[model samples]
Target: MSDSNSILFFVLGCIATLALIALIFKHRFFRQQKYLPKRVITPFERKMFLRLKEAFPQYHVLAQVAFSALITSEDYKIRQRFNRKVTDFVLLNASLDVIAIIELDDPSHIGKEQEDAQRDAMLHEAGYRVYRFTQIPTLAQLRKTISG
Candidate 1:
């Protein structure tokens, strides 16, 4: 075969091999796709959510919501920091303003108190009241906070 023809075949073979590798990786990635349930909250969170709704019936209760969704800033750098964190629950008033934030502190969060404080401080700076409950609260207890 002519040198040119041989070179052409080699180029085509290299391209085909690369394409095959790409396809295999793509197939493996697709196979790894997992189907997760919609709810991301722990069992304790669900209980608190119900109580929060009962306490503030007129308010909107949100679970596992991102901080960026409630607060917005024109500064990109400032906004990006909030985008990375999610609150356990957020209580919004009728006009969609954040009335308060509830953070559940289970055993898993014991070692992360500093991290939690930073997040709570940021929320507080944004003029939102934050309530951190170490144990599960009752409907009466939650209601008392609203009235007090």
Candidate 2:
């Protein structure tokens, strides 16, 4: 074979090897990104999420709205018994620790105040604070909540 042909083959072989390596790494990355059940967020939850994100600009962006769940991670757990699968926005700081669970209470949820309270209690009991924002409070209230 001509020298040019031999060089072309070698370059092609290197490219193919690199492509295979990249595909392998990509497959492993996706494979390790374990999938969990989706969370559903209510309309009220959506509003609350917007307010929270607006209020706390430092706590990362709002997560996707799924049923009552937003963003979740592999380490999320609830009550130390069940997984902390949530709907609505679950905002976090750089630490990866959940900063808040923003829940919006629609008429139904507000009507079932006891149930709401119970859920919040459970979250708090499990060391997860629930940020129940009904009316979008002023920035002052937000600063207080976020700082305190």
- TM-score of each prediction: 0.71, 0.50
Per-residue accuracy of model 1 over 32-141 as CA lDDT, tens digit each = 65876676887888888878888889999999888887677899998887888999998888999888888989899988999998898888888888999998777788
Regions of candidate 1 where Cα sits further than 4 Å from its true position: 1-35
Tens digit per residue, CA lDDT, model 2, 1-148: 9999999999999999999999999998867657677655555555666667777777874554342243233554533323333434667887767777666555556577876776667567657767776666677786687568
99 Cα displacement, candidate 1 (Å): 1.0
All candidates' lDDT scores?
A: 0.86, 0.64
- Model 2 stretches astray by more than 4 angstroms: 1-47, 61-87
